[model samples]
Target: MQLVVARIGRAHGIKGEVTVEVRTDEPELRLGPGAVLATDPASTGPLTIATGRVHSGKLLLRFEGCLDRTAAEALRNTLLIADVDPEDLPEESDEYYDHQLMDLDVVLADGTEIGRITEISHLASQDLFIVERPDGTELMIPFVEQIVTEIDLEEQRAVINPPPGLIDDSQAEVASERDDA
Candidate 1:
């Protein structure tokens, strides 16, 4: 299994270091020096991490052979992928890998079948579950504790307690009207 560890941002300096937006929880293990990562473009890398450091709360990394600003700039926005065992679980009990949640059936508290989780979007604030409905439409549900009440891994399902207007279009109009008032 290949998991995204980081995405290369702008070139940090002339020394080939580039700022990285980390995607993994274990950056030290996944993005540390000596780790070779596959690239999204599949041409820019297989980049080997020569050095890594945290500057101003951001991760900066220098890859082997990318020894100049121009070389580093060419890697901007490239996703760093690391190979891992498909069955690898996150260290934390409450956390889950994207692969674990994918394709799980999503249901409501009252056993109403909503959809299936097709994708997981990792945002700055929180993760979003992209649930695909039976009709082929999609719903972006925030993967927060308040809305997502349960994750039954053994049952292969997620129970959500979405607030008003989240899934129902009529409820959304009511919510909009209330906000205007």
Candidate 2:
């Protein structure tokens, strides 16, 4: 499987270094020196990492053969994809890849089916599972330990303990009105 590891940001300096918005939890392994990554735009790369560093709390990378700012900036907004094996599990038991979580059945602890996971939205604060309900309506459920109580990969299901207003439409509207007031 091919997974997106990062997205190239603006050029860092006059050098060939460019900033990257990391999408993966394991940047060190995927964005390390000598790592060859496939780019989204077929023409741009298969880029090889020459060097990587942390500058001002941002990850900066220099790709092999990208010798100047012009070369680096040209890669802006390009996605970095890494080849991954489907059978390869994360080192930590609690860790899961986005692919692994995709399409899993979402349900309440009482076994009431809610929906199927359609996508995962990765935000700075937390990841959200975008679920498609039976009627084709979509709702975002925060992928947190308190809410997503369990993930049973074998059974292909996620058990959640939703808080008030999270899944209840009427409760959500009431909460919204309360905020407006």
**C-alpha lDDT of all candidate models, in order:** 0.93, 0.95
Given candidate 1, what's the lDDT at residue 65? 98
Model 1, 1-181: lDDT tens per residue?
Answer: 8988889999998999999998887899899899999999899889999999999999999999999999999999999999989878888888998878999999999999999999998898989999999899999999999999999999999999988889988988988899999
Runs with alpha carbons beyond 4 Å of true place in candidate 2: 171-181
139 Cα displacement, candidate 1 (Å): 1.3
Q: Which stretches of candidate 1 lie over 4 Å from their true place?
A: 172-181
Candidate 2's C-alpha lDDT?
A: 0.95
| Cα RMSDs, all models | 2.6, 3.0
lDDT for residue 86 in candidate 1, whole number 0-100: 81
TM-score of 2: 0.90
Top candidate (TM-score): 2
Candidate 2: residue 152 Cα off by (Å): 0.9
Report the poorest 10 consecutive residues by lDDT, candidate 1: 84-93
